[model samples]
Target: MNKKTIAAAFVAVVAAAGIAYWSLGSANAPLRGSSVAAASGNKVITIWRDPGCGCCDAYADYLEGNGYVVTRVDDPNFDKRSIEAGVPQQGIGCHLAEIDGYVVSGLVPAEIIERLVSERPDITGITLPGMPANAPGMAPTKTGTLKTYAFGKDGVTVYSEE
Candidate 1:
């Protein structure tokens, strides 16, 4: 092939590959993992955290272990993202996660997170402030004490005790 023809073909191939990769793995794509229940349908959670935060990685692992399709975003502007997701001032945690129309602030357990999906509460979302001892992804403590709160424009209220 002539140089011009080869270059054009190469560009075409590259564009095709880029499009395919995006469609298959983009945040909006449907869940592909067997662990996720069909009811959830590729229920992926996108988490925004500080790049150097190790606990955030641990939290992501915990979610994956429970079958959640997780997407990790090490954003320098993570705090802005969390606030934009509507995290209450009192509910801010080490990391922020966005679920189906819900903002999860902090180290909430997979169970609580799943419950939010299952129950489909009317509130905006839930929060686990202060990386509670024994909270999923944090060092397990004997007390296992953590407080989960539900919050929205009306403000924050107790969601549950764990």
Candidate 2:
């Protein structure tokens, strides 16, 4: 090929690579939090997630849509933080959250969260464990039952099955 054709080909390849990189980077970028304050009676939930996981953002959206005021923080070391917050290694989820005084892990359902706040269970927090495909925010529609476990100074125990 002529010099101009070769140069054009190189430019095209470079442009394509740049676009691909930007797409991936933005996908993993930390999500911005909502500026709107929660209404008088709304519950406020703060979630910390790995910036590389898209599902965490979806989970935040799920919380917001369910009437909770959600705040998201992108922490690449979220798992370590979860452990530090008393979540067992085996019970770690994709994201970690603090609602009222309890730590919530993974894609737990909104109603369960509401129940936690209402029941005021004496525990450090509740977790849904690993990323279940049918869990809220993980899938469009939930199917089957999801067992949520509570962990605290005592130990991990079954919180509920929804």
Candidate 3:
């Protein structure tokens, strides 16, 4: 088979597997609403993203669904804002959020976001790097674990896994 055919087949297989997993009806399903409890239902998140990015909309929806008050703005200087917010150059993602004085870079899970709020980490914020397949906004394939990194004066470090 050609390369395109093989890649298409692989995607089809993964999609089938994801469907089967979802059929199990587990509340802890990957990429669904995060299981972590909210630190405060009144918390607000302001997301700066490109208006053309559909995944950003999905990410905003995920945050709102988890009790966060989401305000999405299509900022022309999103990259500049992220850099100014202390997001490391390597940790930059498609979108950025300002939450309770922390800069969240990327489609970070609500669980981790809540943990950051509850624990009050000293870091500037957390990032998920490039968008992962099963991340909150991305297409779900039930892939391997997603790594989140914390960035600040101490530099980038593993924050959590989901």
Candidate 4:
């Protein structure tokens, strides 16, 4: 190939690599809401969710509306991270959150989260399990009840019901 063609090819490759790097790097970056939380002196909660999960975004909004500073991180492997953080495989939620050294999984209500933070339970974390129809991020229809479980070295146990 001519010098100009080779140069153009190299430039294209470099541009593609840069774009890829940026996209991948941003997956772990904190969402824009984090800065607002910091400025308002609210408690910061870092949540890891799968990319393009609208429910997770709604949950974050709920948390923010409830006066918590939410810093969201898009992680495709959020379930794995939740399990690694002491959540059982069966207890994996739509998202994983870290607040006040506690692991909160799924679409737990803000009230329950506040209680968890207030009571300072001895468990490693809490989980709401799978997506429920009437959960905070789900549709606004009341289901029978929602159960939040606490899991640690001992095992999973009923934490609360809402």
Candidate 5:
């Protein structure tokens, strides 16, 4: 099989798995409302991403496909913003996001983001450093890989094996 074919297969598989997980897990969970802004509802999420990045847009679409109402903010200086907001430089990535006071960076999986927001872990944010092509937005048309990192008071930790 060609590389694009493989990538499509992988995406399909991941999407299928994600849908199954969301269905079984959040099916009955109460949707957080506007009263608590930026909190996960069954419908929405707010993300701050670089203005010119196609990958960020693609990632937003991915979230939307998963039943998330993504509010995208175009920030040209996301790196500066992230640093100012206390995200560690070592944990920097292509994008930065905020959900109910929690931070998410780069090609973070929607499921993991959900876990972070729901659990409200004492952490700065999550990051997928260097935007590996296999990451949600960073995926190459053919083949690639990504590493997800979690930023906490203890420092950056590898959250997922990708």
Candidate 6:
């Protein structure tokens, strides 16, 4: 072959090799592994809430509507349990949830819960204090003035204004 012909063949070979490597890397790439249930298409989230709390049930329904297969535990000891689980009084909400490994409390929005699962922040959990009317499962009131807080061992801080 002429020198130019040989150079063209070499470039083609290099391009082919690069394409092959890209395809293999793409095929063997690791998944995000955010939700164990999402891998199997179940997308389940476990929740613990007070039995008599109507808003807690409403939150569960909202989660269910947003693709979470909710397993609710209505324990009368919800207050004690949340405290035991590291949820502070100032950070209290309507219910407690475990999504993947992170904690979710009160009437937090479904989108925020999804973000928590996806981002996996190094915190105890997220909370919507006092069940604001405009929060995910809370009753819609005039102002919708619920305050959402993020809680961890360090302390609680307001996360969002609802």
Best by TM-score: 2
Clashing pairs in model 6, backbone N/Cα/C closer than 3 A: none
lDDT string, candidate 1, 41-154, tens digits: 766787778889888998888788778777886676666666767777767888877777677888887778778878888887888887676777777422555789999878
Alpha carbon lDDT at 23, candidate 3: 33
Ranking the candidates on lDDT from highest down gives 2, 4, 3, 1, 5, 6
Error of 5 at 149 (Å): 1.8
Candidate 5 C-alpha error for residue 94, in Å:
0.9
How much lDDT does candidate 5 score?
0.68
lDDT of 3 by residue, 109-161 (tens): 88888899878789988998887878888963325688999999998889997
What overall lDDT goes with each candidate model? 0.74, 0.81, 0.76, 0.80, 0.68, 0.68
Q: What is the lDDT of residue 116 in candidate 3?
A: 90
On residues 1-162, what C-alpha lDDT tens digit does candidate 4 reach at each position? 999999999999999996665434344442222323343555678889998899999888877878876767889988877777888999999999877668899998888887877787898889999999889888653366899999988889999987
Q: After superposition, how far is residue 42 of candidate 2 from its true place, in Å?
A: 2.1
lDDT of 4 at 149: 97
State which candidate, 1 or 4, has the greater TM-score: 4
TM-score of 2: 0.75
Tens-place lDDT per residue, model 6, 1-162, is 999999999999999996665323221222112254544556667666777988888878887878887777767666666676677877766776666656677777877776666676778788876766667776542244556677887688776664
Error of 5 at 108 (Å): 0.5
Candidate with more favorable, higher TM-score: 3 or 6? 3
TM-score of each: 0.72, 0.75, 0.72, 0.73, 0.68, 0.68
How far in Å is the alpha carbon of 101 misplaced in model 3? Answer: 0.9
User: 38-69, model 5: which lDDT tens digit per residue?
Assistant: 44355456566777889899998888876777
CA error at residue 89 for candidate 5, angstroms: 1.1
